[model samples]
Target: MPGRFFLTDPMAAVADALNVEVGVVGNEPARRNIAPGQEIVVFDGALSRMRWGIVPVGRVNARGRPVMEQIINARSETVFDKSAFEGVGRAVIPVNGWYEWTGEKRRKTAWRIAPKGGGFLYFAAITDVWTAPGGMNVPQVAAVTCAPNGDVAPIHHRMGVLLERDDLTVWMGDDLDAAKALMLPSPEGRLEISEAGDVDWDGV
Candidate 1:
């Protein structure tokens, strides 16, 4: 699951790595426990946009609150037809690392999936903004998920659609075909999972 992750780097450092200007998230605090339904930053190769959490179709509203679904991850195989991410919702999240937990509830172990040098992990995601019945615009976004690679399968069955710095333009471009083709699991050794250092998940 891509349910919880961290963006430990400053906005400026992340922007430089993506070659995009640091937008509204100037000096924003690093997110240690990014969950669904909360606003997060995403990059589109050239521009950075802050995206709202996703709410799947048929559950747009829960009473007066935004219907938050257990949809932090999207399957790459059916992304085109999934009710939550049907049309055009291409986006990428440049987070430094993602967490996956194992073991029993009493003794869980959290693994931080990231690059060898602790570089960024440009997690592939999909986003959409549609007008509500009341004419209030609502934006929903979710990261894409694929079958875990060999290294990750032992820890978790699913992982986010990981991307490289060079693939930014194609992953976030207009050609849907090309983007979908890149939704496979990261290659073996492409990512390394280590026991996460002490982090304050509640700080976010």
Candidate 2:
């Protein structure tokens, strides 16, 4: 599961890669250790980071209120059947690298999985709008995850479904079949792994 990521590219680079002119919503800075509930601007859309965990449709209060259970990652195989994802739309998240943990929890190792050429990866995702108690509504985003590929399996058992620039439209559109087809693991030799550096990304 991808709970955190880092995007070091500038807004111009992202826009240029997306082939867009200029503006995009929530243009945040490039940084490390971006956790859940943090906004990120991708090639396809600017996502208003979601709270982590999924809330079932039937999970309500005495008055039949909606709960805000959220999750950062959703299994590609089951996202279509998840109740919380009903009417969910798609979004893109551009990431340079994502981290994985190995060994014991207390003394685990952090590894970064990235493109072999040290470029960006466009991650496919599903999104929903969650309304707050009063009236505020925020978009919830969960990147689709599949079985780890040959390159990533050593560090983790799951990886985000990465898409090429050409597939963004299909993913964000109503082409269910085409979009689903893009949810496979990255091909062999598509990734590179390395130890993560300990940096105070908060200051970034």
Candidate 3:
């Protein structure tokens, strides 16, 4: 799954491609490394910024235990069925690409994955709002993951569930079954993966 993402394209391009108004996400600068817990651009219906990790403040698991950690990615197999995910809204995370690591911790190789034809890859995501002690509402999101397609299998066992441009409405609509139907692996040959050794992880 994607632990970090990149969106070097301009916000205007993203707004134009998605055919939605940029609204409050104005004049956003290009980002090369967006990590978990960082605010990211999301299109639920209109473009907006939301924290990348879902803070399960009062959520509980199926076993009735409190969800202990923040969720950066949710498994597609149980996203809808899990007790902890109930009432979450559906959204999409549009990105230029994402980074994945392989091998051991100190010897890991970084891989950059993006759409083969050079456009945005819309990741299916779930949304929520965390109410802090002062009653401030914090919107958040988590990318949904599924079994990897042939293109990504060598690098990772799972990949984020990608959505077609035409299916964006269906994924964000109120139809549960229709949204669930779109949670499959992206087809092979749709992605291009390469070694990403030049990224300045600390600068972005």
- State which candidate has the highest lDDT: 3
Candidate 1 Cα outliers beyond 4 Å, as residue runs:
45-52, 58-70, 130-135
Name the lDDT value of residue 124 in candidate 3.
Answer: 98
lDDT by residue (89-111, candidate 2, tens digit) is 78888778788888997888888
Per-residue lDDT of candidate 1, residues 1-204 (tens digit): 686767878999988887768877776787787766677778765444544456554533324444446466778888776444546567788888888889999798888887877778888888777566788766657788899899899999888888878887898888888988899998888788888768666667
lDDT of 2: 0.74
The true-structure Cα RMSD of candidate 3 reads 0.9
Ranking by lDDT: 3, 1, 2
For model 3, residues 88-203, the per-residue Cα lDDT tens digits are 99999999999999999899999999998898999999999999789999999999999999999999999999999999999999899999999999989989999987898776
Alpha-carbon RMSD, each predicted model: 4.1, 3.5, 0.9
Count of clashing residue pairs in every prediction? 1, 3, 0
TM-score of 2: 0.86
- TM-score for each model: 0.85, 0.86, 0.97
Clashing pairs in 3: none
